[model samples]
Target: MDCQVIFQPSGRRGTVKKGSSLLEAARKLGVDIESPCGGTNCCGKCKVKIDEGYVDELSAETHISHVSQLTENEKNMLQPQEIRENYRLACCTQIEGDILVFVPEESRSTQQVVLETGKDRVLRVNPAVRNYFVEMIPASLEDHRDDSERLKAALLDRYSHLDKELSIDYTVLLSLPVIVRKGKWSVTATLWKEQVVVALEPGLVEATYGVAVDVGTTTVAAYLCDLTTGKVLQQDSMMNPQIRYGEDVLSRITYGMDDDNGLAILHQTIIEGINTLVTRLSKAAGINVEQVAEMVLVFNTAMHHIALNINPCYVGRSPFAPAVRKSLDIKARDLGIRIAAGGNIHCLPVEAGFVGPDNVAVLIAEEPHKQEKRRLLIDIGTNGEIDFGNKQRLLSTSCATGPALEGAQIKFGMRAAPGAIEKVRLDPVSLEPQYKVIGEADWFQPSQTIKAKGICGSGIIDIIAEMFKSGIIDPTGKFNMQQTSRRIRRDANNKPEYVLAWSEETSIGSDITVTQGDVREIQLAKAALYTGAKILMKKWGTDQVDSVTLAGAFGSYINKESALVIGLFPDCNLDNVVAVGNAAGDGAKIALLDKDKRVEAQEVADFVQFVETAVEPDFQPQFVQAMYFPHGKDTFPHVQHILDTIPTVKRSKLEAL
Candidate 1:
């Protein structure tokens, strides 16, 4: 039997097997519910409320029996109050009949504020795909040259700087005769590398379009560009559909290795995502999807392998070797991409381990290799990719920062969305905190009914730094039980936590807090990132960097002061730290507009050295010291004034326990 299921708020509806779990049904209907545990029912984050009402024509009594009773795991995971309100774990409950489930804002995967804009640089418009308008003489009995030969001759005659040996795509060749005849032997031929015909269109079609995509672990962004003008016409983004499979790269790889069809599912999902972007972008730009000639994509190694349908298990394993390190040119149709019939998809080269082409794209866009000053480029995300050195030399490494910084793995944490607290500041003496949510223009006021939901990555960093500076938490990230503030209290587990928003101020009907565990999760995540930067700096034999360039979506939004206070990287001059929004996406756009940049991307990938931080003997000590606020040993001279204000806790006192 099939059960009709409707997910509220989004109003997405679908039907699933009678035994299907709500999480599975949510996935089927394209309704995103956070399943960080991959639907194993371990995270208990996928909670959905079953409306206490009858379905269409069914009795309330009958509809109530459709949902499976909560199991022992749910009983243990969910709070008693939640169970009484009909809140059940989406992963644990099975649908026996029609049901309307309302996913709470905290459980629903909200649309994130994706970083799509980057610092644009002027580049020569030399795209690999070029369109040429050629007028050929009508063929007769005396001059019966084949359509392919006649088209080539006409192109050479019209342009004069033509490749004598021009090859037409088989699919394009099949339609060549009709297209040329339809326009009375006048046609526009789209060529790849000026040597192969990828598309043949009737009349003179001068508009050549391309899409540049950045496939992040959590989000995917696409930029539609006018190849002829080298200008971006439209841009769109969506959460990476693969996120439902796993919140991070390693988990997604495990899914592929464990499930028989996981790889295909992931690959198809991303392809469909890209196609959706194409359709949307083209429609907005007033063009057909077929007019989009080329695509350039960049992502980390795990995403690179999965998007290519290759098993990503090995990429996640020891000695992390990718299946391919060279740039590849695949047919758009071959990859299930909807574009010009014979268009090509260019994948930038990747470095070793998890450092893939996205990092290469970052390097290309930032041009760190051409600078005289030493630079540190960090693309902060679930997996942090760090690059160090300058024109003389370059090194790179990847760190498993997990999803904590992106608002995963933390209690009361959420992505950067409306109602997400994005900024926090604690008064030095009073320790009273004022915060700003994403949608609000001003700091939250007690007088106003601000429905703050949760703290996001930036807010998490800010709160932790403010806590340390204000003496609410010590350098060791332990709550100071001595504080008399009412905000400092114990959770149900008797663990210490700092309440950011009181129950009356929140939409979740509970106090939003920074728990002791949340602090630990951030500490671990930040340590991984800081340690990776430290390892690269050590390998480069430099104790300091001239500049720090923060790339990617999360990195761009992070407050430089907060980042410095948290010691996300080796301390540099505060003025030198800058965020280049979505540099990887910019690199993809550069590659799409210029053929030379693609070659430069490969060169950059090949030139950089990959450092395996997991194997470093000093990794543990560095990580431990980094776990402290602003680092235990490293000095941030720029932020030293702020540090001096902090009431230092004695190491002996901390270790005495």
Candidate 2:
């Protein structure tokens, strides 16, 4: 018998044999389903809910079935409690007669991070879009001039500063005649940058909006703001759909170069994400998509090329440069952005090498150029970008720091999701560990009480710092053997590993341990971060930073103590180091609201002296020194003392209980 399968929301349908699984039917329909486990039902990602047609339509005894009964693996994977909520693993469930399935957002691999607003910024209200109410004479038989010409004459006469030719868009022109007749020769025209008319209404188009977009390699975020009022109406974010092709910029470049139409594929993926954000933002703000009249985009150099559909193969090579170094203003429709067709999209200035408009945006948002003391801005991610200077001088560089800090390339590593261990600390003498997972409110005092999933970046940093401070790991990050802690053991590869969560205490049904290799990834990442900062410091001729601000999602979550103990950056006053939040996104918002800030961003970009780390002398030695704790010194004594003295609140609470 043939079973009819219908996918919800999209309304795509296909027919399959009764024994065929839902995933097989979805594949036949060419739907995008994330089967990262390759249909093994391991990832627990292919989840769906049955809405209709599951039971026999003609049943005398009220029989119900959607497919075969749940498999043993599926039962174990999804707890019995979740099945009652209409959840089923798509890879394991089969289609029985005819049924309809709903794929929620969580089931999709293109799941997005929650959209976060940048640091609070108060923007000036002067915008490029202006509204003018024009009154024109009715075309009479004596005045044989056409309606369009008469309207243009009135605009020029009433507003002396108007261009001689106040041309309206063809589409707007077609509607202008009817609009004037309806309003009795009075129509509101939305003027863009003095030359062209964007929108027209019988009365006034009171609400015009614009979007500020931050194009991250992992996620893309959009903020919808009122152009005139400078009020942000709505914001949303999603995982860059390009993630399925590759994880990092280097991998994406290789993918784009190796495959035919690879550039187009990557380009379309980001476009799809931006358009999706637009749709969601408009709906959330109770406005039409056409109301959004402008956009400001900021991204890294690689993402910059891919979004513009330009080939970025050269950016991956030496003496790296982008297709363009200056800011660009293009029509939103020209780039397939479904806002107002004639609306403009403004991109900030691109710095030399891998630094793109994002660094410019960072400078604009931070305003370090106007500050008194010397300051440093560090954006940590796949590619760590650092900017240092005072009002007089500015220096910048980019480091290829890979994605290890974001929870990839480690055993039991995962995103900062529910159940992931986000904070950890080990006792100095007893060598006992206490931790907190992402979802649970209370700490895991007993490892068996809370099931450990995996470790994220902050947890990894804390674990290593605590391990080093407590003498469980030596200064070089090697696991100390003299302690003879039960939690320490050798893996199959004969590497010393420290188990944070034992097999019975973890969701993965195995020990969640940090191996020697995991420690090395952190060392390499921190070394890159330190070396870049050192290069800028040497250029500034100062070993001490007046202040440091960590910018970005990962940077915001990292504990300052852990960062210092790991030697991720040079030492300064502990209170001076602060996480400023996503400054790049904030800069994009600034540029979107005020055109003058775009000029300021350009000035910041021009003033910066780009230092190429690869060619700089003393980089290798600094990098090698950076690999050790506190640059292989006996520094961080205060940090070690803090670890020995101040215990976790969880530990204290458990002790009191």
Candidate 3:
């Protein structure tokens, strides 16, 4: 049977099939609803009210909270209870018949994170900058003039209906005469705000071009964008060119400090990398290298300093200062950005030396602190950094979580690139294994195949959980080979290996294993994460947080239960976890589109209270204790309850203590 879906406020209308989930139908129609729990009937972010509808009320067994802070009219439309009603989570409700639904603005998804790859486009074509065609009635025998004078006369004569003031950059004026003469006294000028002449060509055009680059210590991602239309033209990513000198900022700073030419090389390497990406992406978009108009960069403090060849020695010392923590706009050639004639480059604002532009970008994108209840935004990478606050106050700190979680320092570690093992699941009947890789397909399906290379961040979480369950890792984090299964092999190199994929089936030459060193690295990573959480809870004067938001590349793919088993976060309610994918990238997108967001980013950066983790007194003890696999179930009640429900270990050697 056909069912009609009606929306409220203005009664905008749509249709759905009978017995369809309301959220599913809304999603099919390109409606936005915030379901941070991946539509698991949780998060309560997708709440909508049924204005006029015949629908069954949800059972008490539904996991989502029925009550909401919506208005009386909104509540009346939801399946109401005694104290509160009418608010139904979109994911939890099914449309059994005809219905009129009203989606709140907060519930509706805004500026979604569109999945991006080489070809995926992210924005519409109506750009902030546009090209216009202006036809001029050329000088007759009665009037005579040069091209510039004619152009100026035409602007003052024809566009005089408006406040027709024009300013041409000396750079574009070099080609203006030839362009005007070639177009037969008529031309298309790329004018920004109908004033500044950024470009001039022989004919009318549709769009302009720009590049957005995220400069990380390890990776650099570039997105070619159409400035006239604000669409992502092409994207390419590569390892940061500065890695030849060092992996961390301190090392790179030392490199620059020791050598006079170090800053120049660092600056040149990044520019060359960005220029290469711009050239490649521009070619893919069928555009010229010199036609690109602007390049925007977002990076950490040291990366920013190195990109501009600024001295970074003071950034590594006491008080941990930065040369400039505010956003800067400069000429591309001034910073050696090697772009086209009129290209300009903009850098996002920085927070502090340790907490830099990346963190500011994340905050600008997610706005987690907008909640009245406490929420923590953790961006874990080379240096573990976290932002904790609520609607009223905000605080930030950096932890030396190392690069452990990024699959560094561990014996069998790798990034989340193709062939990286990403998830692990035990076979219920055989007590054997099933796993998943990042790209293409799953390990369980016979037709789908992936040769396991090494474990990534998510896989590390699962492996840590499995070790705890197998009794191979004690609460103190000591590996006991005698207690583990025969499948769990030990190497002659004195490393304990948990065989995830065997040699015959794997892409690597030998069995893909998580080694003893890998386990230690994960433990250290977890220690940093948990210790930071503990410290923040102390500063806030309460442990009861409204929610925890994980932000970054790896945050979206992590398993909360596995994370808890590894002691990566404090024992909070599992329902409180929210994964905001690529918050930094989202922030970059916002900064790209909204000029006001740049100001907001600067405000957030200026206000974020930075806590230096290296100096905290309790940091070392908390780090040591948190390194252990959590054992006191009472102390971690929320985590323990989740672990209690998993299938029991079968093999004697693999059983937990």
Whose TM-score is greatest here? 1
Residue lDDT tens for model 2, 1-657: 987777776677877898887776876664556453445555565667777433333231211286668788777666465577566778788877677777764444433234366677778877767677888898788899887787778778888898776787775777778988887888777777767777766764676789999998777778999987899888888776776555578777876897698898889879888999999999999988877778899999999999999999999998787889889988887899988777778999899869989989989988888887889889988788999988888999999787678766565566566667889988788888998887678888453444777787889999988887777776566777667789988876567999998877676566889988789888999999999998898998887788889998888888988898778888767798888778888889889888888888888889998999868888898888889875654245445555444334223336659
- Per-candidate Cα RMSD to the true structure, in Å, reads 2.4, 8.1, 22.6
Clashing pairs in 2: 112-239
Among all windows of ten consecutive residues in candidate 1, which has the lowest summed lDDT?
Answer: 55-64
How many pairs of residues in model 2 come into backbone collision? 1
Per-residue alpha-carbon lDDT of candidate 1 for residues 523-569, written as tens digits (9 for 90 to 100) = 99999999999888889898999999999878788889988987888
Cα lDDT of model 3 by residue, 1-657, tens digit = 756665554345566776666666775564545443334442344667655324343111222221223444334333345124355767657666566677754344322122223212243333323466677666578877666667666665766542366767677778877788788877776654456666677766666777777777767777777776566778777766665455567767876776678777778878888888888898899988767766667887888888877888888887778899779877676776666665567678877777778788878776755668788778766776788887687888777676567665554556676667788876433437778876746564545565666667777888778767656565666666664466667775556777777777556456667777778778877888778877877776776566678776667778977786767777668798877765665566556655567777888887777776657898788778887776222156776664554333223215543
Higher-ranked by lDDT: 1 or 2? 1
- The window of 10 residues in a row where model 2 has the poorest summed lDDT is 55-64
Cα lDDT of candidate 1 equals 0.88
* TM of each candidate vs. truth: 0.95, 0.81, 0.72
After TM-score superposition, the amount by which residue 328's alpha carbon in candidate 1 deviates from its true location, in angstroms, is 0.7
